[model samples]
Target chain A: MTETAPRPTLEAVAARAGVSRATVSRVVNGGDGVRGPLVERVRRAVEELGYVPNQAARSLVTKRHDAVAVVVAEPETRVFADPFFALQLRGISKELTAHDSQLVLLLTEGRADHARVGRYLAGGHVDGALVFSLHLDDPLPELVQRAGVPTVFGGRPGWGEGTRSAVYVDSDNRGGARDAVRHLVGLGRRRIAHITGALDQTSAVDRLDGFRDVMVDAAPGLIAEGDFTPAGGERAMGELLERCPDLDAVFAANDLTASGALRVLRAQGRRVPEDVAVIGFDDMLPVAEQTDPPLTTVRQDIEEMGRLMARLLLRGLRGRGGEPGVGGTPSSVVLPTTLVRRASA
Target chain B: MTETAPRPTLEAVAARAGVSRATVSRVVNGGDGVRGPLVERVRRAVEELGYVPNQAARSLVTKRHDAVAVVVAEPETRVFADPFFALQLRGISKELTAHDSQLVLLLTEGRADHARVGRYLAGGHVDGALVFSLHLDDPLPELVQRAGVPTVFGGRPGWGEGTRSAVYVDSDNRGGARDAVRHLVGLGRRRIAHITGALDQTSAVDRLDGFRDVMVDAAPGLIAEGDFTPAGGERAMGELLERCPDLDAVFAANDLTASGALRVLRAQGRRVPEDVAVIGFDDMLPVAEQTDPPLTTVRQDIEEMGRLMARLLLRGLRGRGGEPGVGGTPSSVVLPTTLVRRASA
Candidate 1:
């Protein structure tokens, strides 16, 4: 049992602040109608008393939990090994902390976990949700929509139904890939090969689209499939070499794959920059800088995307979307990515 | 607002299963006394009806929110840069998911946030808490203890008051450090230098103690303090070399620090292993395997430690704590660490 001390109530805070209980309650629940002086007094009294705003009490008034669930649907170990999700989470944490809202993390590994998460979200346990890494066949996006919780996706949802009206924060994967390929083209490299991430994800598919945007009518042998792993990158690079032995430039889906490509190129006695220029996406520092020759890759503001997801969700929750219960269509965000110059490219 | 579809209640589940409401409740809440056949029937009914347990009703019955708050109280950006917290979070999430519980992540940056966290824990919002990376001067431990919430520390709590009876899960840092030093000694390196992590953290302090156990009368100049970052490691390695030019081996506190030391050694024209046999701790794969000569380091089961902490906390919450309200004294767990020998050492 928790220590048996009774917590200070709104009445206590009101008494200390010389204000009405109603005023204290209003201030605690975002101070909608409370005046500035009264709000300041109530806040000071609450702070002095070390009082925590009771979610139960607050829910009784607003019917809101002031909590958001971040659902990450990743069945593959490859995503977990990279720092992409972690960096995004840091941004989300910082933003949510500033908002004084709690973060509930829900990680779904497979079909069963997805169903479980769908049920939890449907149970009205949280005010909103931030769902991430949805594959082409994932049912989570639709499930969340059916649950009717205001949600902001981390990336563009790949599934067809219900996502056309959905809000999401995504980096310009297509444009970033275009920039990378353009940089390689500007370097006087004629035969450029492309190594793609797992095609199931929209991020990878979008990058491939961007690659095709620049490399119009390129030889089919110049493309190889990689699952965004170092080993996968090495294998893909080897296959690309076998098919196009004279290829002078390579663009990988992510830094991990590019690092693997770098190792294979080094082992095959191909000097970076001199013999072959390499560029990757998602400039993950550990992988990019640790490469024999530091990698030049596309940089996405991952943490900022996380922050934006929370900011948008919270704004919707604040009734800024429209009427109190009928949250209007929340705006979606697409952040731009820049090419980070390094020795490899 | 959430979809208006009425959630199936306990009465509905009971009616569907042809059993009493109490029996359905027991099955839903872990099937404590319900028989196998009846439990099966209730589960099927639950599945058929899509019955999601109402947290409000459950709290009224069992006085538990079925939520665990994970408090990470590191003010430094270095901790966020690495993937350490993410791996631990994955382990905790998996365990919590298996147990049908939710995770509320509380990230505290400084003193003000600490107070906010303390009040939240005191407000009885969660059933328990798992706090990590506690500094010696941290007030969170005391606040948690006073709240009377069952907590499982990720590392040993550093405070003196109210923590003697606290439960925790930790890796054997001392033993791991001793093994690293012994391996170097076996390699016929007499003059070895040590780079210590921040002394405020118990992990670093325990590691330093282990180094002292192995090098009883070593020169004071051989030990340099690092803040568990790459830059700190570089500075420490530089200082160690300037002070003791004859040192043949170096044991860094963690892999990030060791990576920095490796760069410094390379820049100073010192051939690794031949001139300076370097070992690191944590064996964080991204840093360890990606280093110039892959690092040989101490391997602590960080994810396992996270899993164990959740397991212990859940076991305590299941009324194994003697009285229903008065949780019994939970035992602490200290997991062993092994040395992963690679080319560096």
Candidate 2:
């Protein structure tokens, strides 16, 4: 009931501190003009009054919200379902908290919402923006850039050749995929089919390219593409089976796709590892464990990726220059992906 | 680069509109008293000059942030891994967008961070707070209440005898559990075993109580506790098997627990449905399908729960006074939970 009472104001605090409103404002703003003893006196006055500086007023002067918006260019369902997003979000939250900043999560799925989001960011609602799961030609990048707001991407944008510059943190997709396929080839499988992810994403393309690089040398005839979704994997698997009936093994772009491939293989009465060995990427723990005979897959530290993304955003917020282009200082940090060998492969 | 230029101030808009500063403020605030032609003239001037009201300056008067903080007490890994949280979050996000508000996601796992969160909410960082996955005797509710901030719990708090009231949206755990057990009993399962969620949660207690209520008449000696983690389910299953070796069926608290139970049952050489039937709750789609022999479980619309929570918070924000006990009228919305039969039971 008492909470419904009017909130305390800065003027009230200034009155209590026995100082001019301008002096109190200077102390509250952390401006250097306020002396040490006077600052301590103002602080004591603040504590006694339990006064919180109006964030809006502070933001007006500073032009900083002390908040970062993470814009996901996907549906809310996909953003929530993907472990990658969750992990990155955790990192961002943690880093922002350390700096006394708030994390604002925005999902730009529908076209109307997309425009609304663009306006919100442009209207100075947050200090900077971090974007994730971008497609080849998302207008968000250019739009935010034109607004003069510092923007970073979670992964490299799919389009634009020659040194596209946006600070990004990505996993070692290319090397990891190459290593996964090389392992399959080492097992002496000649026909290694691959289920790709959404072609519009750089992650999917890099992963597919890695698989192809190894296959072109090891086995020329075993290449296939599938969307990252499980159903996509299943459909692509069925197609691959029809096209290459004798294919001895398959590499999936992600765990969801791999799970689908495994189901299709089981449905077709193919013995796992013996008749058709299977390997999936992004060894999401639960999915990896649930698959029949488990799943042999590539493991990327999703939490670390999230943490790095947050760090990059934080560095940008602090105006720490010299980020490695679109990929960050390293251009792209390729976190090591290890193979977790299980029954399927 | 034009965006980096200082935004046009309210004073500029006032001058351009040939009006007093208060008139310009009233127009920007959408306050009553401004006439139609003047309002239209002021609006056109605002559009012409691309004048966006400074949120910080406005907040000093309004004391509202137009932001809501969503606090997840669980760790980042759990938040990301659980489909339930993600689905609920999506619902909340969608609703918040419609209300033209921002959402701040806070994960309060660490002790230091928890205190920081308490202070942040108390300091008027967010308009209101929505807490999820609260454990029994958690001091957060009391802390936030003492801070004079309106707070809502995702589920009912576990401690006390319902003396503390907070607006909550929850599934009918009792009815869902009863339905699951009753279905198994209808199928002539004499030795039914219940795998419950963590005892610290109200949902877990309600679910176990429901199972006990149905089994009290049919088969009384069938109950086991699980922490809602897959590993916890496995341990609980092992214990149940040791105590009730002839158990013919199971009703797990959640899909993860059910999956674990299924794994353990398979390892113990039990055939699903044919030999030992199983039913899990919280019908997470992918996990339900991935379970060996699949799983029959209780399905609650997680997204709807999220939407309702957001709506409740928005209502509180709008001063509509429909919220139960805390600010306005308290309503306990119990959504229906349905049973989906599959290969498991």
Candidate 3:
């Protein structure tokens, strides 16, 4: 390892290039409107001195860091255990790269990290933020609002006071759940059971609403609570079976939950689609396709949703003309979902 | 939505608090030696005015950003599709959060993005970098090396010149592969086939060497190329069966590839552990446990690897004592791997 010399500044570059400070600054900014000879000399001086532009100084002038903070508020590891967040992040990364920006990831553990995140956001280190998986009653919305940075939430946030004015991007969870239940109903299956995701998230609540939109008068024991994990799904399925053994169909909130239900059903000797039909949300090909009988699932464009979030934030940024919103709102978008029929249903 | 006010600066806080600029700076930078009354006055003024201390100005004085850049140089999306990288990132995030440092993610698509990453590291926006999934002949190592940032590669970099001095944290790929093959051999399965991940990657190459270490002089027909994707695993399985139909066991480079092989074997009516056996590296629970009859795979502590990467970098950062490495080298670490026995074999 070699020792690193102190980083060269604009003044040093100017001194080395035998040019004025303003000339060096103008050249470093873009080299536009500068003579070819002078630009070449400045470039040579910068290369010789290994002068990497100081972001702190540049940000002071430009009010931009070319960075966006992606705040994922998932305390549990199960969400990351699957590809859900990774896919969303990949989408966000692609869009940010296309726009020549960087992603600063802030993973929040719980209430303790919230203050840290709030302080970081308020510190003016980033131009905007793209937040994900915000739970009901989460203080992030209000904190971000107070910070005054442009933000786009991943899922539809739990409707609470002060969050109505917030902008977000989400999949049509309720509509997708409705379609899954409708498809099952059309298959002539009655006594349908619904497995719900963790109710803390708005997606889970909305999905439960979709399930009810179809089975409005379902039996009391037909609904089971799952935490969108295979283990949670397995336990929920067991509880549902104990309560309602005659249920002919199951609608799981997500593919992972559906997988667990399938495992338990297989263990209970209930053949899929013959004795019990199952449909799941989130086409999530890897899990959906690998199920004993390939899962019939509702497909939401997850990556597309992520891309839309970035696009929406970028649009808001442009609309504000490089200023944080002074007195206006950014519209939210809800992408649609479609049923992908497979062997299970 | 309400209009946002321009952020208040240090001068504003100083004026409002009726203190000198130096006193306000001292208060904002932690109030180490400031009087309690004066500090309280400055704090009240900052809160009342919603002042955000300029990171640019602070960094100019302290020469630190308290951020680490995590560079994932994977062009293919397959790795992200599974929980491999996600689990690793989760561990990294936990460690970084405990240290009160932020994570700045730099995902590179291909050769083009390498230059951008190089420039960013050179620009001194981050204190250190943790790079992942570097392939053979990749120029990122050289670029990062020249940038002179204290870096720790996630996996072992290709043995290129100038990379011998690089610090890294990796799993015992060869040892894990050896354990998997040994487990398969212990089951009395003759004519075992090998499914290698992308040979471009050092992990894959090392695993192949391990397989060769066990099955010295195995027939060429038993080896098939896979790009660590399920689809690639399926294709490789098909080709291996075509070349050597009697091959009784397989050692896939990763879990995703193993899942594909399991699918193909089931489709071909070859019962697992009866006529054929399968072993996979990376005991990625979602894929490993969900596979039909579960997977007998080698378990690398992925999350621990990520944690160690952050810890190693943090150690290096602290050792440098806030200076950019005045010529001291950090030792590399390679964690051990264990074979997890399950129903597949």
Best by DockQ: 3
Deviation in Å, model 1, residue B281 alpha carbon: 3.6
The digit string of per-residue lDDT tens for model 3 on B44-104 reads 9988986767666677676677888888777526446657777888888889889988766
Q: How accurate locally is residue B140 in candidate 2, as Cα lDDT from 0 to 100?
A: 65
Docking tier of model 2: it is incorrect
Top lDDT hit: 3
| All candidates: TM-score | 0.79, 0.76, 0.84
- Residue A80's C-alpha lDDT in candidate 3? 57
| TM-score (chain A only) for the predictions, listed in order | 0.82, 0.88, 0.93
Please tell me the interface RMSD, in Å, for model 3. 3.5
How many residue pairs clash in all the candidates, one count each? Answer: 2, 9, 4
Compute DockQ for each candidate against the true complex.
0.24, 0.21, 0.30
Residue-level lDDT of model 3, residues A1-345, one tens digit each, is 223345677899999999988888888877368898999899999999867776666666766667788888776364456678877877887887788766667655455677667776765567788888877788888667667788898998776554776688999999999999999899999899999998999999999999999999998799999988999899999999999999999999999999999999999999999999999989986889999999999999888887888877776776776455543356788889999999999
Query: Which candidate achieves the best TM-score against the true structure?
Result: 3
Docking quality tier of candidate 3? acceptable
How well is each residue in B70-170 modelled by candidate 1, as lDDT tens digits?
88877524345666776777788778878877666665445567766776665555789988888888888877765557788898876667577678899
lDDT of 2 by residue, A1-345 (tens): 112324556788788888878888888877878878888888988888766665555666766666677888777767776666776777777777777766667654344466556655665557787777877766666555544566667777656431166667777888899989889889998888888898888999999889878877644345667778889999999988998899999989999999999898999999999999899888887889899979999998876776677676666655534435433232345577899999988
